[model samples]
Target chain A: MSAVGGAAVPAVDERVTRVNPLRRAFTRPEMGAVAGAVAVWVFFAIVAGGNGFLTLRGTASYLEVAAELGILAVPVALLMIGGEFDLSIGSVIGAGSMTTALLAAQFGWNIWPALFVSLAVALALGAFNGTLVLRTGLPSFIVTLGTLFMVRGATIAITRITTGRTQVGNLDEVAGYDVARTLFASSIPVGPAALPISVVWWLALVGLGSWLLLRTRFGNWIFGVGGNTASARNVGVPVGTVKVILFMLTAAAAWLVATIQAVNFGGADVLRGSDREFFAIIAAVIGGNLLTGGYGSVVGAAFGALIVGMIQQGVVYAGIDADWVQFFLGAMLLIAVLVNRAIRSRAMGGRG
Target chain B: MSATVSSRVAAPAPPELAGTTPLLEVRDVSKSFGSVIALKDISMSVHAGEVMCLLGDNGAGKSTLIKILSGVHPASEGEYLVEGKPVRFGSPRDALDHGIATVYQDLAMIPLMSIARNFFLGSEPTRGVGPFRRFDLETADRTTRDEMAKMGILLRDTDQPVGTLSGGERQCVAIARAVYFGAKVLILDEPTAALGVKEAGVVLRYIAQARARGLGVIFITHNVHHAYPIGDRFTLLNRGRSYGTFAKDDVTREEVVTMMAGGEELEELGHELEEFARADGLAAGRLGEVGRELEAEARG
Candidate 1:
C-alpha cells in the first residue's frame, strides 16, 4: 500500500511459512549434478591418483577442457530452461572462429577488431534464428536445426572461396594478439597449477547467469515464457523478447568460445565446433535443467560441465579406453536426468 | 427468488438496472467465424458486487461471447462498453488495462512454478532500479500468502508448485490472483466444469468472496445448479441467441432448466433419436430408452 507499486502488495511481516528449510535445500535442481561431479572425482582419485589425476596439474588439464565447454553449456542451459533449443551454436562457433581468423590473419586486421566483428556476426545470426522461430511459429529445434546446417554450409563455402582451404593460419602475426591471448588463452598461476583464463570466464558467466535467473525480472519472464507461453502472453509477459534474448546469449557464448580457441591456436578450422552443441546440451541436461523447460539452474550446468570435464580427462589418467568417453557421457546424462525427475516430482508433491 | 418471469424478459437494457452503472456491459453483440455465426444478438451487464451468470450448453456461443469479452476476439457486430465508455481492446492486455481480467479455464498459471511465482507471472514486482533491479521473491511470497488467506485458503507453503494443488484450489488461486491484480470485472470461463463437487463448492465460495469484495463477476457455466444459487441474474443463451436475461426472482430452478434445455426442441430430438434407434440395432436398447425419457420429459 505504501510503495504505489501496484494493487498487489505484500505486508512483508506475515512469516508463518510452513516449508522445511532442509527439504527445500535438497530439492535444488543442481544438487544431483554437484553430487555426481563429486562422485566422478572420487572415483578417479582412487583409481588414477597415482597417475597424477589428483595432482594440481591434472586438475588444471581437466578444468581447461571443462571451462571452454562450460562457457557454451551455461548459455545453452539458460536457453533450454526458456523452453527452446539453439542447435546452431556449434555452427555459430565455426562461423565466428572463421570470421575472427579471416579478418585477423588474411585481412591483416587487429585481433580485437576481428573479434568484435565476429561477435557482431554471431549476435546477428542469433537474432536471425530467434526471429525466424518467432515469425514462423516453428519449434526452435526445427528452426535452429535449419540454421545449424545453413550456418555451417555458409562458413565452409566462405572459407573455401577465400583461402581454398578449410583451415586458416598466421593469426599469431595479427595486431593486439598478445593482449587478446592474455585475456582469453593465457593461464593464471594457482599454487602449482597454471589454470586457463577461460576457467575464469566460465565461472563468472555461471555466477552472472545464476544472478539473472534467481534475482532478475527477465529470469522470471524466461520461466513464464517456457512454462506456459500462452499464459505468459495472457499476463503481459513479452514472450518473444525473452526467447530472442536467450538465443542471442547462446550465440554470444559461441563467439566467446570460438574466439578463445582460435586465438590460442593462432588459427581457425571451418569444422572447429562441429558437435559442441550436443555437448553443451548434454552438460545442461546433466546439470539438472529439464528438457521440457520452466525449471533449471545455471550453477547446475557448471557442475554438469565439471562432471563432463572429469570424465574426458579421467579416462586418459586412469588408462581407460578413450572410446568409453561417449558412453560415459551418455550414461551420466541418463543418470542425472533420472535424479532430476525424482527431485522435480518431490518438489511438486506438496503437503496436503 | 424462484418465481416465474413477470415481464421485461428480453429487454436489452432492463429498466430495473439502478443507481450506479454496470462495470461491464455489451449491447446487441454478434460474432461470426467465416460463414458460421457463433453468437448473435447477445446483451449482458454485470454491476459491481454482482455475479451475472452466463448459462448455456456446449456449443451454445458461451465461449465465443467470453472470448469477445476478454478481447481474444472481437465481435463482428456489437458495442463493448467498460465503465460506461465504448472501448475497443486490441488484446487481452488492453482489456486488463481497462481493469477487465479473464481467468481462463486453463488458469494460465505455470504448473512447475511455485504458487508465489505463478501468482505474479508476467506482472512480477522488482526491487531497485535498472540493471540491478531484481524479482523480489519475498514480496511475491508474502502477497500470495495474504491474497490466498483472504480467499480462505491456508496454504501449506507459497513455495509449493501450483500443479500440486487440487482443481478447486487452483481455481481459487486464479480468481484470487485476478482480484489481487485489481481486476474490476472478472470473466471466469467454465471454472467449475472440471472440478469435483467439493472442489466446485470451494471455487463457488471463492467466487462469492470475490463478489463480496465488490468485484463484478461473469460466472460462465453449463451447470444450472451451480449458477442458480450464487448468480444474481441469469442470461440463458441457446443456438447463438439469448432466450432472455432473467433475474433469479422472476425464475424458478425447474423453469430455468426447462427453458435452457429447450423443451420443444427436446421433443423433436427425441423423435429423431427413436428413428435412429430403429435403424441401428446395436445401440437400439439404450438409444430407445433415452429417446422415451426425452419424450416423457418434454410432454410433462
Candidate 2:
C-alpha cells in the first residue's frame, strides 16, 4: 500500500513513502484510550450533570479514586509493555500495609520506622517475585498468580497469629503517624475542591514513566524485549533483566498504593486491596495496552484508571446500582480491546 | 556421494584472491556434537565486494557453519581468519565487535517498533549527560533514513513500525543496520527463502547493493535460482560435507543444483522411485514425478 499522505507531497524521491503527520498521532498507544476517556467523560457529564457529576467536588471525588488506581496501573502498563504481568500487586498492597500496621500498632513501634521497614519488606517481596519468575522461566502470569495467593495467605496468617485478629488498628495513635500522613495522605486545595496527594503521586509517576519509556535507553530496551524477546536477545538486548526490573517496579507501585490506602483508612485490614489486582489490569487493558505484550503506553493506563473512576462514581451519581460498576468495567475492557485492535492494525499498516 | 569431500576442499582462497587476505576465511573446519559429526572438513573464503552463496538442502550443516562463522559456537578443529590473522570468538557479540555481522533468517527486528528504534535496538544512541540523557531520536531517524537510502530505499519517515514494511524491505533494513554498524563480512541466512518471487528479486537486488557498497556477503539458501543470479561464487553442501566451491562462470545452474543434491545419489533415488511408481499407482506417481525432475537435474 502507498503511504497515507504520499500524494500530497510533490515528487522529490518518487520511491519515498510519505508519512502523514495526522496518521502518526494515531500510532501512539495512548491515542485510543485518550479518545475513549473523553467520550466517557462526555457521557457522564450529560447524564449525571444534575446529580453534581460535573461539579468541582465531584471531579475531585473521582480523581482521588482514579489517582489511587492510576498509581498501580501505570507500572502495570510498563510491565505489560515489557511483555510480563504482576498478578500479586493486590497481595503486595495487603502485605506492605500489614507490615506497617503490625509494626506500629501491635508491636507499639513508631510509624516512621514501621513505614521504613515496610518499604524494605515491599521491595524485598518485589525482588522475590522478579527472581522467582526469572529463575524458574515460568510465565509471569502463573508465577505472580502463585504469589498472589501465597502473599495473601501469609498476610492473613501472620496478622491472625500476632494479634488474634484479621485486622490492625491504633495506627493513627502511633508516634510518627502525623508526619507520615503529611507526606502521603495529605491533600492540596484546588479552587472549590481539595485534591488528594495521591493525584500528585500519580501525575509524577506518569511523567517519570513516560520519560523512561519514550526517551531513555532502558525504555528502548523495554519496548524491544516486550515486542520480540528472541529477536531482542539476538541483537544483545538483556531480555531477562528488562522483565525482572519491570516486575520489581510493579511491586513497588503496589507498595506505594498500599501505604496511601492504609494512611487514608487509619488502619490495615487483611482484606484491604482485594480484587485490586484485577482492577489494575482492567485499567491497563482499557487504556489500549495489548495483553500479548510489546505494544502499550503508561499514559493510556492512567486514562484507563480515569475511566474506572468515572464508572465507580458515575453509577452512584446517576442513581444506578453500585454493583453494576463491575459489569460496566467488564464491558469497557471488552470494547477497549476491540477498539485497540483496529487502531494497532491501522498503525502498523501505515494507513492511519 | 560416498567420498569424504576432503579432496575437493579449496585451499582457503582462489587465484584472484591469492595475494590479498579475504575478509573472512575458514580453513578445514570440522565440528562434532559428542559422537555425531555436524560438519566435516569444510573450507571457504569471502572477499570484500563479492557474494559467496552457501547452497544446501536440509541437514546440510548450513546452520552449523553459520554458527561457527558468527561465533555462536567455536570450531572443533579449524582456523577462522579475518585479514590473515586467526581469531576465536566466544560469542556472537565478539564476532560482531570484530566486524562480522550475521543477518539471520528472522532478521532480528522487533515488528511493532519504529524502523529507527529497531535499527538501534540493543545499542541505542543517546545524547546529553547523566540521568537526563535520552535516546537521540534525531540522529537515529536521520541515520536510519540515510542508511536505508544507501541500500537503495528512500523513506520519508523512519518512525514507521518494521511490521508495516514488506519482507524484502525488512531484510534490507537488517542488512543496512549491519552495514551501518561497520560489518565487514555479512552472513545472510536464507534471506529470500521466505519471500515471493518479486520479493525475492527485491532482496537479490539489495544483496547486489550490499556487494556494491564493498561488503563481503555470505548468502545461505537452498534455492539456486535466487542465488545463481547475484552470486560471485557458489559453495555447495550435501549431508554435512562440502561438495567444493565453484565460481559462477565455472558451473551452470544445473551443475550447481546437481552437486548440491549429491549428483550420483540423486540419480539412484530417481531410478528407485521410478521402479516404485510401476508397483504403486497414484501416490507413488507423485513420487515418480519428483524422481523424473531429479533424474533430469542429475544428468546436468
Candidate 3:
C-alpha cells in the first residue's frame, strides 16, 4: 500500500478490515503456555480421578506448592525477558529464612526486626548480583551462579556456628511471632478447603508484575534492552538500571516466599528451597520464555508454575513415582518452546 | 519552509533559503582513530528545506563524517556550527536536543515491537503520574498512523510488528517518526543501499517528501543516480578529503559517477587488469568469464 506503487495497490479501506479478536488472542506469546496448562490439568483430572487429586483439599495442596514457586517465577520471567538470570534466588530464600531464625532464636531479637533483617539480606544479595553483572560486564548467569554457592555456604555455616544444629528452631517463642504468623502463614477457610495465604500473595504479585510488564515505560525499555542492547542504547534507554531493578524484584519475591515458609513451619532448614532456582527457571521456560531472552509473559510463567505444582502433587496422588516429575518438567520445557516458536512464526508471517 | 522546494530540476535556491543561515555547518572537520585519519578537512552546510547529498566511494570517510555530524564521534579538529552558533556535542542526545535526528542504517528499532511502540521507543507518550503512569497506546497508534500517512506511507495496521514491513516501508516509518518528533536536520545513513529497485524508489520519494516538509536532509549514498534527482547540493568525498561541493546546476550525473569511481585512476586500473589477463594464458579464460558476468550485469 505504498504510494510509490499506487498502480495496483488495493483500496486503503479494504486493507484496514478489523482483525479477528479471537485470532489475535490466540497469537499472543502466552497462548501456548495457557493451552499446555489446560491440557495437563485435564490429563491429571482423568488419571487421578477417585483418588482425591481433583478434590478441593487436593486442589489446595497443589495450589500451595504453586503459590510458593509462582511468587518467584513471576519475577524470574521478567528477568528472563530483560535478558538476565538470577540463579541466587533459591539461596536468597535460604539466606532470608536463616537470617530470621538466627536473629530471633539465637540473638534474642524480636521476630519483626528479624524479618526486616532477613528482607535486607535478601535485597543485598540481589544488589550484589546486579552490580557485579553490570560493572564487570560478565553474564548474570555466571555472576548469580557464584553467589548461589556462596550464599548457600554462608547460610549453612552461619546457622551451624550459632545454633547447635544446621536448622534453627523455636521461632514461635519469639515476641510478635503470632502477628508475623497471622500475616504470612495463616490460611483462609472456604467451604471444605483451606487456602494458604501465600496463594493470595502470589495472586497479588502476579497482578502487580503483569501491570508492570504490560502497562509502563519501564516495560517497554525492558523489551527494548533485551531485544537489542545496542539499539536500546542508541535510543537512550538506561539499560543497566532497568536490569538492576528487575534483579532486586526477583530477590524480593524470594524473601516473600522464605518469610511465608519460615513462619508457617516455625523454623529454618539450612537447605530450604534447595534446587528451586532450577525449578523457577524451568517454570519460566515452560511459560514460553526464551532462554536467550527478549520475549515472555508473567501470566505464562504463573501457568508454568501451576503445571509444575500439579505434576509434583499429582504424581503422588496417582501412585506414580516422584522422580518422574523432573523428567516430565524437562520434557515440558522443550515442548512449550517448540510450540511457542511455531505459533510465533505463524502469527508473525513466518519470520521465526 | 515549503517555499524552498520545487518539483522542477535545478530550481534556483530559494530567496529565504539564501537569506537565512544554514541549520548546520561544519568547517574543516577531521576525525582520526589512533594513527589513522578517517576524515580530513571536510566542510559542508545544510540549509532548511534542502536535500544535501553526500557522495563518496567506499572507504572515502562518508561514515566518519556522518558520525561526526550525528554526534556519534567528535571531530578530531575544526568547528561544528548549528544555527550560526558553535556547539560541541557530547552524545547523540545532545545533538537531538538541538533538533538534530539521525536515522542510522540499522534504524535503532526493535523488530519485535509494534510500529507505534517503535515510533515512540525512548520518548513514549504517557499519561498519569508516578507509578500510575502508563504508555498511551491510543494516542501512540493514532499519531503513528497519522504521521506516516503524512509522509505518504499508509500502513494498514499500526499495531503490526516492524519486522513484517518491507525495507522501503521501514525507512519511510523512520523518516516519518523523525519528522513527527520535531527533527529540524535529519541524517539518513545509506537508506537505499540494501533495498531493491522498487524499494529504493519508495525511499527516494520519502526523501523528497521530507524535503517538501522543510526539514534539512543529509542523504548519504555512493550511488550517483540516487543522489542526482533530489540532491540540491552534492559533496564528493574521496580518500578522506572533500573533492568539492557542487550544486545540481553545476554538475552532471556522469561527472559525479566518474569522480565517485576515482575517475581516470579507475580506468587505468581496469586497463592494467585487462592487460594482466591478456599477458597470462590461464588467466585469460577465467578473466573472460568474469568479463562476461560484468557485461551481463551492465546489460541488466
Candidate 4:
C-alpha cells in the first residue's frame, strides 16, 4: 500500500502470514469467556434434565437475566478498558428509576418527559463523576464509590419525602406510559417461547459495543489511555475527553436498564439495583478485561454476563439451594480471571 | 589556545547547500523555572538533511531545550524560530502543527497496543462517514508494516503488541511514526542510551537515514561514540549553556571527547585523588596498604 496523504514512503517488506493460527485463536482474550459460557450451559442442561432447562422457555428465562446484566457489563467493560471504574452505575440505575417514577407519578409529568429527565440526570451524574476524577486527579474507583452512596441516599430520601414510601408505583397511569412500555418493556413471541425486550436491547448493545471497541478511533484512544496515560497525552489522544465520555456511556447504559425494569414491572423500589455493579464488574473480568485496564472485548463481557445469568437460574433448576448462586458466581469469577490471564500471556506471543 | 581551538572547530559547508535557511533555530533562547535558570542564551540551528547532535550530561539543560523546541515550554527569553520565522508555541500540539515532533526517551507509545494501533494512535485513518466511520484497519496494518520496513524494521505481524519489540525496534517505530506524521524536524531524546552496542548501531543508522530522507533531525545523547558517526553538526552543552556548535568537518572525535569530559575538571579530580591517597598512606594500618596499592595503580 502506498502512503496515504503523502505521509510516508512505503517500504518493501511483504511477509504477511500468521505464524500459527491455532496458537493465535487460543490467545484471543474472548476465548475463555466463550468457553465459560458453554460450560455453564452444558452443566445446567445435564443437571436439570427433564426440567426443560435446555429448551427455548428455559433459555429465555436465563437470557432475560443475562440481558439486564449484559447491558451494564458491556459499558463497564469499556470503562475498565479505558482504565477507570464506575461504582456508581448500580446507583445510577436506581436513581434513574426513581427519577422517572417521581417525575411521572408524583410531579404529574408526561412519561416521555420523565424518561428524558431520568436519562439526563444519569448522564449528568456520570459527567460529575468524570469531572471530579479528572479535576482532582483522584482514582475513579474512589470518586465513583463516593457517587454511589450519594446517589443511593438521594434516591431513598427523595422517594421517602415525596411519596411517603421507599417505592413508587402506578406508573402505567401516567401520560404516554403505554408507548414507553410497548417500546422498552414489551416482549415478543418466538417459537415455543416469549423473549424479554431487554434481551434484544442487550444483544444490540453488545454488537454495538464490540464494533466500537474493535473498529473505531475513539476505541484506540480508550486502549491507549488505559495502557499509558502519559504516553497517550504526549501523542495528543485527548485522554480526558475519552475517559469522561466512557463514564457517561456507562451511566447511560445503567439508565437504559433501569427504564426497562421500571416499565416492565410498573414500579421501582429504592433497592432495585443494589450490589449489581459488582456483578457487572465480575462479568467484565470474566470477559478477559484486565482490572488494571487497557485490554478487553465487549463480546467477551456479553458472554460473561450470560454465564452469570445461567448460574443464577440454573442453580434453581438443578434443585440446588438458592444461596449456592453466590458461591458458584464467586468460583466462576476466579476461574475466569485465571483463564483470562493465561490467554493474555499467550496473546503476547507467550511472553511473561 | 582559544584561537587554535576556534580555527580547528570552524565547519565548512558544502558549496551548493551553504545558504539555505535552517528548518528550526533557537536564537539565544533562555528558560527559567522560578528562581532557577534551566537554560540561558542557547543558540542552535538545524538544517534540512542534517543531523544535529545535542550532547550533554545529566542536568545540563538538554531536557529544557528539548521542551522549549518542541513547545512543551516557551523560552523565558529570546526567540524560537521555524523556517527563519519567529514563533511562540502554546503547546506540544502547536509545535506539531508547525511540523516539529519530539520523540521522547520514553518513546510515547502504549506498549500493550498493537503495532498498527500504536502507529496510528492520534491521527488515525478512517473510512466511511458518521457512525459507520471506522479505523481503516487494513490500511493501518499495511502502512505500519511498510513504513516500519522502510526504516529497516520488518515485523512478523503488525498485529503484535509493541511491547514485544526490542528497544531498537521500538525506537525505530517511534522515529518512523514521527516521519509518517510529516515531522519536518524530528527530535529524539537519548535514543540509544538504553541500547546495546548492536542496537545502538541500528538507531544510529536510522538517524543518518532520517537525515538522508530530508528531515532535520536533532539527536540528543550523552554518548560521544554514538553521536560522532551520524551527526552532521555537534553542539555540546555544559551547565545550561552551549560550548559552541561545530560542523562534522571541523571537529575531531578526540577533541569532542575531551570537550565532553572537560580537561581541567579531569585534571583537578586526578590531583584530588592523589592527595586523598597520600593522606591515607600515612595511616599505619592494613587499610593503608590497600589504599597505597590503589594509589600506585593510579600513578602507573
Which number leads on lDDT?
A: 1
Worst 10 residues of 4 chain A by lDDT: A1-10
Question: Which parts of model 4 have CA positions greater than 4 angstroms off?
Answer: A1-18, B1-18, B261-265, B271-300
Query: So what's the TM-score on candidate 3?
Result: 0.89
Report every candidate's CA lDDT.
0.88, 0.87, 0.84, 0.86
Candidate closer to the true structure by lDDT (higher is better), 1 or 4: 1
Give the per-residue lDDT digits (tens) of candidate 2, residues B1-300. Answer: 334344444444456766877999998999999999999999999999989999999999999999999988999998999878999988787888889988888855778989999999888899999988999877887778777776677765577788888888888899889989999999999999888999899889888988998999999999999999999888888888888888876668887777777778889988988889878988788988988987887887
Pairs of residues clashing in candidate 1: none
A184-280: candidate 1 lDDT, tens digit per residue = 8999998998999999999999999999987888988888887888888888888889988999999999999999999899999999999999999
For A6-69, candidate 2 gives per-residue lDDT tens digits of 3322345765555576876876788888999899889899889889999988999999989999
Query: How accurate locally is residue B250 in candidate 1, as Cα lDDT from 0 to 100?
Result: 68
RMSD of each: 4.6, 3.5, 5.7, 4.5
Candidate 1 lDDT: 0.88
In TM-score terms, candidate 2 sits at: 0.91
Give the per-residue lDDT of model 4 (tens digit) for A191-250: 889998999899999999998988999999999988888778777788889989999999
The segments of candidate 1 whose C-alpha lies over 4 angstroms from its true place after superposition are A1-21, A350-352, B1-8, B11-16, B268-300
Best of the two (1, 3) by DockQ = 1
For candidate 3, state the interface root-mean-square deviation in angstroms to 1 decimal: 5.3
